[model samples]
Target: MKVLIVDDELNIREGLKKMITAFCPYVSEIGDTYGVQSGLEAIKKEQPDLVLLDVELEDGTGMDLLSSLDVIDFQLVFITAHNKYAIDAFKFSAIEFLLKPIDTDNLMHALDKAKKQIGNENLAEQLQILKQSLNAIRANDKKIVLKDINSIYFVKVSDIVRCESDGQYTQFHLSDSQKILISKSLKEYEKLLEPYGFIRPHHSHLINRHKIVRFDKTNGGTLLMETNCRIPVSHRKRAHILQVLDNQQ
Candidate 1:
C-alpha cells in the first residue's frame, strides 16, 4: 500500500516515515508533504492508499484540505497534540488518531485499524460526525459513531436510553428500540457520557437520566426506562442516584 505523511514539522514527518519503513511491511511507497496546499497537491499526484494527516497546517487545518476534496478514497489517521476537545471529537467520531510525540505501539495499532478499514464507505460519514462534534456548541447536538463487527451506526446522544455492560462489550438501547452492541467496555463510555447526564446506577448498567420513566423503590431500587426495561440501581449508587434525581426535580 502507498502512504502519505502530511505535517508541517520536518522532524515529525521524518520520524513517522522511518517508523513506517521499519514496521509497516505492506507499505510499498511513502510520500511526505507540509501544509494543506502541498498536502493536497501530493494527494492528487500520489493517489496514496493511506494518509497520516496532522490536524494543524501552515496554510490551513487538515479539515480544510479534506473539505476541498470532492471524494475521499483513502484511509485516514489523524495526528494531533494533547488537546482534550480534539481528542473527544475523534472519540465521538470513532476515528483513529495518534497524539503528538507518538508512541510506536499506538502508531502500529492505528495503522492496523486503518488498514482493516481501507475500503470502508463510512469514512465520509465519520468525518462529518467529527466536524459536527468539533463545531457543536451543545453536547446533546453531538452524534457518536458506534461500530459493531457488521455495521457502523451514527447515533444521537439523546436517543440512547441506556447502555448495558456485557463483558468487554457495551450494548446501547436507543429510544427508537434499536440496539447496537459495540466492541468497547462500558467503563470507557462512562467517562464520555457522564457529562451528558448518563448515570452509572449499577456496575453493569449506565442509564440516561432523561430516559428514566420512573424510579421504583420495590426490590431495593430500580429505574423504569423509557423503553419499558427495568434496570437495577446498585446499593452503592442508590443514594447518589436518588440525590441526582431529586435535584433534577
Candidate 2:
C-alpha cells in the first residue's frame, strides 16, 4: 500500500518515513508533506491508500484538511501531542492516533488498524461521524459507533447504562434492555466512556453515573441501575465512588 506522512515537524516526518520503510513491509511507496496545503496537494496527487497525519500543522490543523477534502477514500491515522481535548475528540470518533515521541509498537498497531479498514464500505460514513463528533464538544451531541463480529451499532453515550466484563469481552447493557457483547476488554471501555460520566465501580463493571437509580448499602454497597440491574461495588472503590456521586449531586 502507498502511504503519505503529513506533519509540520521535519524530524517527525523523516523519523516516521524511516520507521515505515524499515518496519512496514506492506508499504510500497512513502510520500510526505510538511503542512496542510502541501499535504492536501500530495494526497490529491498521490491518492495514497493511507495517510499518517498530524493533528496540528504549521498552517492549519488536520481537521481543516479533513473538512476540505473533496473526497475521502483512504484511511487516516492521526499523530498528536498529549492534548486531552484532542484525545477526547479522537476517542469519541473512534479514530486512531499516535502520541508525541512515537513508539514503534504503537505505530505498528495503528498501521495495522488502518490497513484493516482500507476498503471499508462505511469509511465515508465513519469519517462524517468523526467530523460531527469533533466539532460538537458536548457529549450529548456525539454518538459512538460499535462493531461486533456480525453487526454495527451507532449509539448515544447516554443510552449506555453499563458495561460488564465477560472475561476477554464486554457486555454492554443499553437503555432499551439490549445487550451487545463486544470483544474489547472492559478497561478500554472505561477509558473511552469516563469522559461521558461513566465510572468503574468494580474491576469487572463500568456503570453510567446518569443511569444510577440508587445505591444500596445492604450486604456492602450495591448500585441499582436505571434498568434495575444490581452491580456490586468493590470495597476499595466504594468510598471513591461515593465521593464522586456526592460531588455530582
Candidate 3:
C-alpha cells in the first residue's frame, strides 16, 4: 500500500508517518505534504493507494482539495478533530474517517478498511456519493445515495418505506414498489437515517416514520408500512415506535 500524509502540521505528518511505518506493514511507499497545493501535486506524481488527509490545511479545507480533483482514484481517510456534524456526513456516506489525536488502533482500523475498499470499481461512484452527502449535509437535504453492484440510486430519504437486514446486506423498500439491496449493514443505515426520522422497530428492520399506514400493537407489535409490508416491531422498541409516530402526527 502506497500512502500519503497530508496535513498543515509538520508534527502531525511526521507522527503519522512514524506510526504508519511501524504498525502498517502493508504500506510500501510513504509520501508527505504540508498543505493542499503540495498535497495535490504529490497525489498527481505519487498516485498513492491511500491518503491520510487532514480536515483543515494552510490554504483550504479538505473539501476544497476534493473539489479541485476531477477524479479521485485513491482511497481517503479523513482526519478531523471532534466535528460531530462532519463525522455524521462521513458515516452517512460510508466514508472512512479518523479522529484527531489519532489512536494507533483507530488509524490501523481505518487503514484496513481503506485497503479493502480501495481498487474497487465502485470507488469513484462512492466518492461522488460522498461529495453529494457532504453537500446535502450543508444544505440540510434529505436524499441518500444507495448503490448496488452495477448501479447507483439517488433516493429521497422520505421515499424509503423500510430497510430490512439480510445479514450484511440491507434491502431498501421504496414508496414506489422498488426495492434496492445494498451491501451495507442495517445497523449502519439505522445510524445514518436516524436523524431523518427512521427508527429501528426491530433488530432486522428500520422503518420510516412517515411511511407507516398503521401500528398494530397486539401480538407483540407490528407496523404496516405504506408499501403494504407488515414489519414486526420488537418489544423493546414498540413504545418508542408508537411515540415516534405520535410525534409525527
Candidate 4:
C-alpha cells in the first residue's frame, strides 16, 4: 500500500518515512509533503492508501486540509502533541492517533488497526463525530463512535445505559436496548466516561448515573438500571456509590 506523511517539521517527516520503510513491510511506496496546500496536492496526485498526518501544518491545520477534500478514501492516523482535549476528541470519535514524540509500538499498533479498517464505510461518519467532539462545549452534546467487528455505531453519551467489562472487551448497553461489544477494555471507557457522570461501581461495570432507576440495599448493594438490569456494587465501592447517590439527591 502507498503511504504519505504530511507534516510541517522536516525531522518528523523524515523520521516517520524512515520508520515506515523499516517497519511497515506492506507499504510499497512512501511519499511526503510539508504544509497543508502541498499535502493536498500530493494526496491528489499520489492517491496514497494511508496518510500519516500531523494535526498542525505551516499553512493550515490538518482539519482544514481534510475539509478541503472532496473524497477521503485513505486510512488516516493523526500525529499530535500531548494535548488532553485533542486526545479526548480522538477518543470520542474512535479515530487512531499517535502522540509525539512517536513510539514504535504505538505506530505499529495504529497501522495494524488502520489496515483492518481500510475499507470501512464509517470513516466519514467518524470524521464528522470527531469534528463535533472537538467543538463540543458540553459532554452531553458529544457523541461516541463505537466500532464493533461487523458495524460502527454513533451513539449519544446520554443514551448509554451502562458499560460492562468482558475480559478485554467492554459491552455497551444503550437506552434502546441495543448492546454493542467493543474491543477496548472497560478501564479505558471508564476514564473517558467519568467526566460525563459514569461511575465504576464494580470492577466489571461502568454505570451511567442518570440510568439508575433504583438502588437496592439487599444482596449487599446493587444498582437497578433503567433497562431493568441489576449490577452489583463492589464492597469497596459501596460506600462511595452511596455517597454519590446521596450527594445527587
Candidate 5:
C-alpha cells in the first residue's frame, strides 16, 4: 500500500522512510515531505492509503491541514514530540503515534496496526475520520450523518440507544425519545458503529452496550434496555453477549 510520511524535521522524515522499507515490506510507494503546506500538496497529489503525520510543522500544524481539507480519505497515524496532544488522538481515532527520535520497533508496531485497519479501504469511513478530526476540540460527542429525502440530521454517537433494522434501512433509537431513520443498511451501520460500543445481538438488532439494563440467560434470553424495551438475545450471541455484559460490570 502507498504510505505518506509527513513531518517538519528532515531527520524524522528520512528515519521513518527507512523503518518502513526495512519492516513493512508490503508498503509499495513511500512519499516523504516536511511541513503541512508541502504535506497537503503531497496528499492531494498521491492520495496515499496511509498518512504518518507530525503534530507540528513549519508553515502550519497538522491539525491545520486537517481543518482545511474537505475530507480526509486516508488512514492517519500521528508522529509527534508532544505528550500533551497524545491524549486527544484517541478522540479523533488516530491509529497510533511515534514519540520524538523515532524507534524502529514502535514504528513497525504502528505500521502493522495501520496496514490491518486500512487494508479494507472503506472510503466512507475515511471521510468520517476527517470529519471527526475537525471536531476534536469541541466539548460534545462525535456525530454521524443520516440523509432522508427531506432532512439531514447529524446524530451524536453517545445519544444512540440501539439500532433496529427495517426492510431497507435502519432506525436509530435515541435517548430523547425520538426515532430517526438512517437510509443505510444494518451491516453498514455495524461496521461504522463498532468502534463505539454498538454490537450485533441479533440478526436484526444492534445494541448499544452503554444502554443495557439487564439480561436474562435462559434458553430464550431477554435483554432489558434502559429505554424499557426488552430485546431478545439471539442464540448465536448468547455466550459472547453474556461475556461482554460480564466484562462491562
Candidate 6:
C-alpha cells in the first residue's frame, strides 16, 4: 500500500510518517504535502492507496480540498482540530477522522478501520458520482456497448434510435442508419438501459426518447424516428410505453 500524508506543518507530517511506517508494514510508499493546495496536486499525481489528510492548511481548508478532489479512492483519514466536520466524513463508510495532537491509540484504531474499508467498492459508482459532482459531463460518451462483427462498439445511450430483436440477434439502430447486431436478448439491455431514459415500446423494441421524432396514439402506434426509421409498437407494452413518453414530454 502507498500513503500520502497531508499536513501544513513539517513536524506533524514527519512524525505521522514515522508512526505509520513503524505500525503498518503494508505501506510501501509515503508521499508528503505541506498544504491543501500541494496536497491536491499530490493526490492527482501520486494516487496514493491511503491519505492521512489535515483539515486545516496554510492556504485552504482540508474539507474544501476534499470537495475539489475527483473522488477519494484511497482510505481517507481526516486529521483536524475541528469536530464539526466529522459529520460530513461519516457519510463515506471508509473515512476515518482523528483530532489534532493525534494519539497513538486513536491512530491505530483509525488505521484498523481504514484497512477494513479500503478498495472494496466497485470503481464505476465512484467514477459516476465524481463526474456528476464535478459537473463535467461528456455528451458523446457511450454508456452502453453493441457487440457487432466480433467487436464491441461503444454507443451512447442518447444516439440510439431503437433496439429490435431480429430472431436470435439484437439490432441497434442509430440516427445515421447505423445498425449493430448483438447475439443477446433485448430484455437484457432493457433491464440495463431502461433506467436511463430508454422506453420499451414493444417486446422487440426499445427506443430512446431523445431520438423519437413523432408517434401515433392509435392502436398499433407508429414511432417515427428523426432519421425516418419507423418501428412498430407491440400491444403488450403499448400503454405503458406511451404513458412513459407522455411523462417525458
| Highest-lDDT candidate | 1
lDDT of 4 by residue, 23-137 (tens): 9899899999888999999999999988999988999988899999999999999999946877998998899999999998898899888988887889998897787556443
- Against the hidden reference, what TM-scores do the models get? 0.56, 0.54, 0.54, 0.55, 0.48, 0.45
Off by over 4 Å in 1: 137-249
Better of 1 and 3 by lDDT: 1
Of the candidates numbered 1 and 5, which has the greater TM-score value? 1
> Which whole-number lDDT from 0 to 100 does residue 203 have in model 3?
93
lDDT of 3 by residue, 121-185 (tens): 77665566566556445434467899999999999887788899999999998889898999999
Q: Report the lDDT of model 1 for residue 241.
A: 93
Residue-level lDDT tens digits of model 6 in 1-249: 788999998988888888888887777898999887888899999998878887678888666777687666787777877544343333332346787788878887887777777885743344333323222122234467667767978787667778888877888887778888898888888887754556787777887766788888776887888888777888877888777677544
Off by over 4 Å in 6: 83-94, 120-249
Q: Listing every candidate in turn, what is its Cα RMSD in Å to the true structure after a full C-alpha superposition?
A: 16.4, 16.5, 14.9, 16.4, 10.8, 14.4
Query: Which lDDT values do the candidates have, in the order given?
Result: 0.90, 0.86, 0.83, 0.89, 0.78, 0.73
Score candidate 2 by TM-score against the native.
0.54
**Which ranges in model 2 have alpha carbons more than 4 Å from their true place?**
137-249
Report the alpha-carbon TM-score of model 6 versus the true structure: 0.45
Question: Which of candidates 2 and 4 reaches a greater TM-score?
Answer: 4
Candidate 5 lowest-lDDT run of ten: 131-140
What TM-score does prediction 3 earn? Answer: 0.54
For model 1, how does the per-residue alpha-carbon lDDT over 1-249 read when each residue is reduced to its tens digit?
889999999999999989998998988999999989999999999999999999889899999999999999999999999468779989989999999999988999999889999998999989977876664424566698999999889988888899999999999999999999998999999999886778999999998887888999879899999889999998999999998888555
Give lDDT: candidate 3, residue 16. 91
Candidate 3 residue runs with Cα over 4 Å from true position: 139-249
Sort by lDDT, top down from the best: 1, 4, 2, 3, 5, 6
Clashing pairs in 3: none
Cα deviation of 222 in candidate 3 (Å)? 35
Instruction: Enumerate residue pairs that collide in model 6.
Output: none
TM-score-better candidate, 2 vs 6: 2
